[model samples]
Target: MKIAVCGFVMGIANLIPGVSGSTIAVIMNIYERLLNAISAFAKLKPSKEDTTFLFYLGVGIVTAIFAGSLLVSLALKAIPVVTYALFLGLVLGSLSTIIKRVNKVKPTYIAAGV
Candidate 1:
C-alpha cells in the first residue's frame, strides 16, 4: 500500500513539467530499492518480491497518470489561469532543491544558458 502511494505521488509529479518520477522516488527514500528492482529485471532474474513491488508500483503509476490527465484537462478548460499558475508554482518549488545539487556556478555558463 505504501509503495502504491509512493508510485501515485511519483505519477502525479510526472504530470507536472520539469518534475521527474525518479526525483520523487529519491525524496521518498526508495531510489536505491527501485534501481535494484529494475536491475533485477534487466538481468531477467527478478525475485518474487521485486516482481510484486513492480506490479503494484506500475499499477499505481498508470492509474494516476490516466486519472490525472483527465483532471488536468478539465482544470485547464475550466480554469486555465489557475491551472497554469499551479504548474508554475510546482516548477519554482522544485528549483530550490535542484539548485542545492549544484556544486559550483560559473558566470559564463549562466550567461550562455540565459
Candidate 2:
C-alpha cells in the first residue's frame, strides 16, 4: 500500500515540469529504501523475500507511471489551467516538507563557498 502510494506520487511528480520524481521519493521518506531494493538485484545470492517484494513494488510503480502519465496528458489537453494548477499545488505542498527536512545553515557553512 505504501509503495503504491509512493509510486503514484512519483508518477505525478514526473508529469510536472521543474519537479523531479526522485525528489518526491526523497520527500516521501522512501528514497533509500527504493534504491536499496534496486541495488539488491545485483547480488549473487539475493534474498528471495526481498526479491519478491521488489517485484510487486516494481510492477506497481510501472503501472502507476503508465496510468498517471496518460491521465495527466489527457487532463492537460482538456483543461490546461486546472491541470497545471493542481500540479503546482502538489509541488508546493511537497516542497514545504523538503524545506523542513533541510538542516539549518550556519554562518561558517555559508561563508565556506564565498
Candidate 3:
C-alpha cells in the first residue's frame, strides 16, 4: 500500500515538466527497490517479491497518470498561473531534496558551472 502511494506521487510528478518519476521514487526512498524490480524483468528468472512490488506500483502509476492528466489539464485551462506556480513549487521541492543530500558545497564549483 505504501509503495502504491509512492508510485502515485511519482506519477503525478511525471505529469509536470522538469519533474522525474525516478527522482520521486528516490525521494520516497524506494529508488533502489524500484530499480531492482525493473531490472528483474530482464533476468532469466525473476523473484516473486519483485513481481508483486512492481504490480502494485504499476497499478498506482497507471491509475494516477490517467486521472492526473484530466485534472491537471483542467487546472491548467482554468488557472494557468496557479497551475504553473504549483509546478514551480514541485520543482523547488525536488531541488531542495537534492540539495539536502549534498555533503559539501564548494564555492569554486558554484562559480565554475552554470
lDDT of 2 by residue, 10-31 (tens): 7667778868778888997878
Model 3 residue 51 distance off true place after TM-score fit, in angstroms: 0.3
Clashing residue pairs, backbone N/CA/C < 3 A, model 3 = none
lDDT for model 2: 0.76
Better of 1 and 2 by lDDT: 1
RMSD after CA superposition, every candidate: 2.9, 3.6, 2.2
Maximum-TM-score candidate: 3
lDDT of 1 by residue, 1-114 (tens): 999988998898888777788877877778888999999999999999999988888888998899998998899999999998998887777666655666876897568646
Best by lDDT: 3
lDDT of 3 by residue, 1-114 (tens): 998898899898889998989989988989999888888888845699999898889988998999999999999999999999999999889978976766887887567633
Worst 10 residues of 2 by lDDT: 105-114
- Give the distance in Å from residue 39's predicted Cα in candidate 2 to where it truly belongs: 2.5
State in Å the error of residue 20, model 3.
1.0
Question: How does each model score on TM-score?
Answer: 0.80, 0.74, 0.89
Error of 1 at 51 (Å): 1.1
lDDT at 82, model 1 = 97
Q: List the residue pairs that clash in candidate 1.
A: none
The order by descending TM-score is 3, 1, 2
